[model samples]
Target: MVEIEYKNARVKLGDPDLVYEPAEDSFLLADAALEDTESGMRILEVGTGSGFVSAVLRANFENVRIIATEINPHAARCAKKNGVEVLRTDLFRGIKPRSPEARFDLILFNPPYLPTSEEEKVPVWLNYAFDGGASGRETLERFFAEVRAYLRPGGRILVLISSITGVEAVQEKMEGLGFDVDIAGRTKVSFEELVVVRGKLS
Candidate 1:
């Protein structure tokens, strides 16, 4: 069990073997993105660790409905306890709109942007939440490839990438995918530089 305080909520995380470190960057990125959405926005939160972002969004938006996805089963269960519409998914698999007509106005993620290193002590659940493959961009690439299918016309996506993961490389990747991207916010942490990238689908 791990405990984290985020967005004024004490969230308990359960994972028998993995040590949970709350990603402050993830929570901050979600807050920044929420400012840009309207009151009734439909939101999708990817990687809903402990449901911090979902809880915050629920509090702020009166008519908002959040669809949260987690790769870890334990995390999904934890998020469900927080009143989130939680689904266990490896990335975006197993999640789709209630109807083909349903789509999200805002899609958010604070993905595992830490580049994998040989020296790091990685546990099973942490790997699902922290490993971004050899270059630390593999998961981002996969998300970008699949995002359009779930987005409403002119919908926006906000995500966090760190300097350790090569922030500029992520921007270039988004551009090559034809998204109009911008830096929504930035913060410096003890170990990494956190930035929120907002991409609008054309």
Candidate 2:
């Protein structure tokens, strides 16, 4: 296990080669989450790779319930080791709310937003971390389709997307889904600007 510290939180990565390592995007999302989260809120994090972002949230919040989902087995284990409650399943597949109150107050996702083609695909679990299927919004699109059912009334969503992933397009999609969407955070990296899209149920 590889351990690293960020924002006063320590995270363990099971296998660096197999699990997605925390990078600039991860830290950016964590910062954004910290700003929006409150005490006693329920939060769900999708694809919690090294559990970095969720761990950061838990370390800083009081009475906050956080659950995470990861499709990669290695990543799921890594997140567990980092003290995150993680489900080993695809996005929202294993999560079913028993009632309206069971829904989350906030949902967070730092999806794989790389535009990758078939020929660039790797035949390993790591591919799930970065393969966004040609348009860099495939998994993101899937998440938007199912998120509303799991979110409470007036709940919020914080998602990280890159400039190359089509930020405006993502905002438009969220608006169409009945979310009052806006850019909550932004940072320019080497080649792309990462944006945190915040959406409130409307």
Candidate 3:
């Protein structure tokens, strides 16, 4: 279990059989986004396990609508239990925009980017957070391709990527996709390299 305080609200998270610290990078990324932009904008939280980010956003942004997505039903349930309206979507596939021209002003994701090992098959419990594909770039690739369609002009995307998964590879992909990317925050934990990257639609 991991605990974090975002916008003065406490959130507790537990994922069985997986080791991870929740919401630190996500909060840093979100704070950067909220600080750098004006408020009352539409926000989307991808992979919203337990609703920590969504709950914090709801508390901070008045007149803002939060659309949270979780691929795992259990996570979705947990998010809803925290008073967030969560959508069950595989990434952005099932999420429909409010209108043909509607797009999110801020998009956030804490994706599963831990590179898998050949010595072990991914455990089912880790599926909600771990199991990034061979190079750990599969989910990021999909987000890069599809997110453009859902992002407003000049909108920003904040995401967490682990150094173990090759941040440079993901950065190159985002650059190739025409995004202006920069590392907004980072923390070097004993066993993990965590960072938050902010991407602006260019």
Choose the strongest candidate by lDDT.
Answer: 2
Task: Write candidate 1's Cα lDDT for 81-161 as tens digits.
Answer: 777898888778887645434888888988888788766737677676788888888888899888878888778888888
**Root-mean-square deviation of each candidate, in angstroms?**
2.5, 0.9, 2.7
For candidate 3, write residues 1-202 as lDDT tens digits. 4566767666666564432335466666566656654566888888887777777777676688888988877677767766788888888878865553479988888887877665544546456577677787678778888887888888888888888878888778777777899997888867778887888885
Residue-pair clashes per candidate, as listed? Answer: 0, 0, 0
Model 3 accuracy (lDDT, Cα) = 0.75
Candidate 3 regions off by >4 Å?
Answer: 1-4, 12-23, 97-101, 123-125
Positional deviation of residue 155's Cα in model 3 after best superposition, in angstroms: 0.9
Q: Whose TM-score is higher: candidate 1's or candidate 3's?
A: 1
- Kindly state the number of residue pairs that clash in model 2: 0
lDDT of each: 0.78, 0.94, 0.75
* TM-score between candidate 3 and the true structure: 0.86
Expressed as tens digits, the lDDT of each residue in 1-202 for candidate 2 is 4689988898887777899999889999999999999998999999999899999998898699999999999999889999999999999997996577889999999999999999999999999999999999999999999999999999999999999999989999999999998888999999999999999995
Identify the leading candidate in terms of TM-score: 2
Q: Residue pairs in steric clash, candidate 1?
A: none
Pairs of colliding residues, candidate 2: none
TM-score of each: 0.87, 0.98, 0.86
